[model samples]
Target: MTSQTFGVQDLTLTSVSGSNVDSMTQLHDSYDLAGLTLPNRVVMAPMTRVRSNPEGLATASTATYYAQRASAGLIVSEGVHPHVEGQSNPLTPGLATDEQAASWVQVTDAVHNHGGRIFAQLMHGGRVGHPDNTGGLQPVGPSAVAAPGRGFTPKGPQDFPTPRALSGDEVVEHAASYGEAAARGIGAGFDGVELHGANGYLIAQFLSSNANLRTDSYGGSIENRVRFAVEATAGAVEKVGGHRVGIRLSPDSGIWGVEETESRELYLALLEQLSPLGLAYVHLEATTDDDTLLALRKAWDGTLIMNPARPGGPTPAGPEDARRWLDNGADLISFGRAFIANPDLVERLRDGLPLAEADPATFYAGGDRGYIDYPTYRA
Candidate 1:
């Protein structure tokens, strides 16, 4: 049966505000995203595991971690640094060097072997990085402003430093670097790459009116502020074709002190440029209001993945939450913290099994205890 025939069902969404779409999506259905046919509408949301070694390479444990959760329709790997300066947190993985890219072969191979698809999330920390975490190398951003928060370090959380402002030429190069990372990710056996343009990182920093205090062509105006993010995505599209690229965005999420006064206008302009690229999909977090999000959904023509739960909300995104979003025009639903302890999350959700609770202590302590020891459901 087609999506139009949700006939005689109690589950129905009459319409969403600010958008013309009067349709609803089902969770267990398949979707044609760009060219790849996803088996289900459940995407494994990317979370920062920080399980890599000091050399910025993924471990065999990392391979096992993702392989166990391969039942999801699509897996978006944790934030991966495209370059040294972009490394957001300590002990995170990278796709910067040839060696680093090679290190992920096991991860991609394992996921593919388990009949799963995976994408690498290219993230740049910008002013959020501490020199202590990046081997004394100062971070860089669109402006010299420092984010108003602490950054993770070996000693403990330290104050974020003022990043060196990038010149116009460097900004262009940094934007193009997404293409280089996309090539490496593809070569490393990933199905595609997702540009991490949200959660107050480099792209978000550039988009923020405060973080990106530049008078140049890359700042101030809405179009100018979105230039860096657009260039970054376009670069990836140029290198790996539009079908192989996706981007994650959290409009109006003031994480790490990045703020947008006119989020709706800014994102609409950003999406206008991105739509012509024919991206595989656009993953959006529910940072902004329903009206703004629905408006964005209408503006974007391709597949839309929605993380319905608010960031850092007390409760995780649950089945009910998924149903609500699916009914409201989201093509796919993502679960972040819910996927942590429940490796077989897809099966559990499909079969109506209970989920396991995750240990917060061992989340980033860098051990196998909470990372891979979570067992699947039992009768």
Candidate 2:
């Protein structure tokens, strides 16, 4: 692997990949999502890097880091915890503080100044969190069940913490937190907001029966389980408007011990419920097979953004993968690892250029050496 961050070598690789694309320029052209025009279809998917201030606020480093990738058509920021109990790790950032909200202002300004748009991804860790990470605050979830695997604590990996089962009033409290966080996101000057209802988080936990044993209005049947996500979306929409909000779902994914009995039935029902909301878009994980993804596309009437889960590689092959989604009814494609290696990925894809190899070691490390140092195509 080349130690050099960015240069002609990276561009050369992008050219190699670009040649496989059907139409480089057309692929690089702009598109619209929820009436917001994106300069191109290259979206930077939300990535977690345990970089935050001691108080869980977004620091200057976080702002600088995201600003470096402002060339993306749309940059979805890392999961920002809506509530204090939502904190999954000590390193995760939060939007609960005025300081954190204030710090994100620079990030928005940087991206906007560079002609890029951004959205904040709101996440509630639920059962995924540990009391050690949240100042001894009990992790809240739909039930008291613990996840199947170990979680990272400040010292090291520890058993999954037993979460406090939320009551009717607590559920409402969490929803209110989501609404307040969405408002904070807009206050931070984000172009829009994305609700992280995927990856076995709080919302997804509620949607899965294995995690939620509640018999109340918030649990049991698919409709009852999916109510939390629907309400969470409603909360965000109420704060930022439906047009400025998006929701991500991993219907078939069993991530972090979230077990859905009837995956298809539950997700389709959720989609049907969300259909009337007129959301900005529905982002599904790339793990969904072609058949399943196609079904979702048909069910959802709004913009569909698919994350192509590339095996053995962090980033998907841009043009070809994007074309696949486009052909399958996806209006946009989100790239996670690709944006890490190529800051000017859109330009490279447009020019039929090679992509720069990403350094996995620096993916979560706090430094400009890997974050902002990625080079763009010089020619």
| TM-score of candidate 1 versus the correct structure, residues matched by position | 0.94
Provide the TM-score for each candidate, comma-separated: 0.94, 0.91
Looking at model 2, residue 137 earns an lDDT score of 94
At residue 155, candidate 2 shows an lDDT of 75
Worst 10 residues of 2 by lDDT: 7-16
Task: Pull out the clashing pairs in model 2.
Answer: 13-354, 13-355, 14-353, 14-354, 14-355, 15-353, 15-354
lDDT of each prediction vs. the true structure?
0.87, 0.80
Pairs that collide in candidate 1 are: none
Best by lDDT: 1
lDDT of 1: 0.87
**RMSD over all Cα atoms, model 1:** 4.6
Q: Write the per-residue lDDT of candidate 1 for residues 1-379, one digit (tens) a residue.
A: 0011122123344444333223445576788877788888889998898889998999999999999999888999999998888887999999888999999999999999998899999998988898988899899999999999788988899999999999999998888888899999999999999999999999999999999999999999999999999999999999999999999999999999999978999999999999899899899999999999989998988889999988788777877677777767788999998788889888777766667767677778897988998888763
* Model 1 misplacement above 4 A: 1-24
